[model samples]
Target: MSATEHATCLAIAAARAAADKKAEHLAAIDVSERLGLTDVFLLASGANDRHVHAIVDAVDEAMHRAGAKRRTREGFADAHWVLVDYGDVVVHVLQNEDREFYSLERLWKDCPAIELPADLAHGGSRDGDSLGGRETTAS
Candidate 1:
C-alpha cells in the first residue's frame, strides 16, 4: 500500500520546515511498500552541525504542531545525522558529509518520490527566498 494522506501531509510539513532553515537536497521517499515501520522518509542536508540542528528543530516543531508525536530521535548530540521519527513520517536532517556517506536516496531509489508543494519541491524558493513560511510564485 502507498502512504496515507496523513503521512504525506506530515512529510510535507517536515520538508517545509527543513527548507525554512536553509536545508539542501530535500527529498521525500515513499517507503511504505519496502518498510512497514513508516510510510514516508523526508531527507535533507545542512551545511554544518548548527544548520542541521536548526533544520531538526524546525521539523520537530512543525510535526508536533500538526499533532504528530515524535516516536524516536537520534544523533541530535552530534548534530551530524539527526533522525526524527514521527510514527507515520521520519525526517532526516543530516550534515552534508554524512548525507553523502549515507546516500539514502540511492538506497531507496526503487521507491517512488512524493511530490512536495511546488515551492518546496526544490531546496529553496524559486524567487531565491527562504521556504516554509514564505509565499510561492503563482502558477
Candidate 2:
C-alpha cells in the first residue's frame, strides 16, 4: 500500500484502539506532505494521566498487532503527553492540558487535514468540541 493508504490504515487502527479504551478527543493529522520522516500524526487526548497512559497502551497494542515497530516512546511516566513513534506514523496520546499547551494542530495547520472514519471522528467529546473540531468526510 502507498504511504497515504498505510497512514490511513494506521490512523483508523489507532483510533479504534483509543476508542476501545474510551479515550477522548481522538484525531489524526495527515502530515505526509509536510513531514518527510512520518506520513501521519495520530493525536488523541485523555481525561487524565491514567487515561492518557491507557490510550497510549491501546495505540501501542494496535500498532504492534499490525506488525509495526516502535522507533521510540516517551513521556509515559508523566502521562501528560505520551508519544509513540512508528516510523511512518507518530501517535500522541496526551492529556487535555498538555495537548492544549502544545497545540500541535496549530503547528501543523499548514498541512491538509485527513479524513478519518466516521466513528473515529465522532466517537467522543472533549472540551466541548470534537477532537480539534475538525471534520473529515470520506470521499
lDDT of each: 0.81, 0.78
> Pairing residues by index, what is the TM-score of model 2?
0.86
lDDT of 1 by residue, 1-139 (tens): 9999999999988988888888887878899999989999988888898988889999999998999999999999999899989999988887877876777777787888888776764454333422232222223
- Of candidate 2, the 10-residue stretch with the lowest lDDT total is 130-139
lDDT at residue 18 of model 2 (Cα atoms)? 86
RMSD per candidate (Å) reads: 5.7, 2.7
Candidate 1 runs further than 4 Å off: 121-139
lDDT of 2 by residue, 116-137 (tens): 7666653444455424554353
**Cα RMSD (Å) between model 1 and the true structure?**
5.7
Local error of candidate 1 at residue 24 (angstroms): 0.7
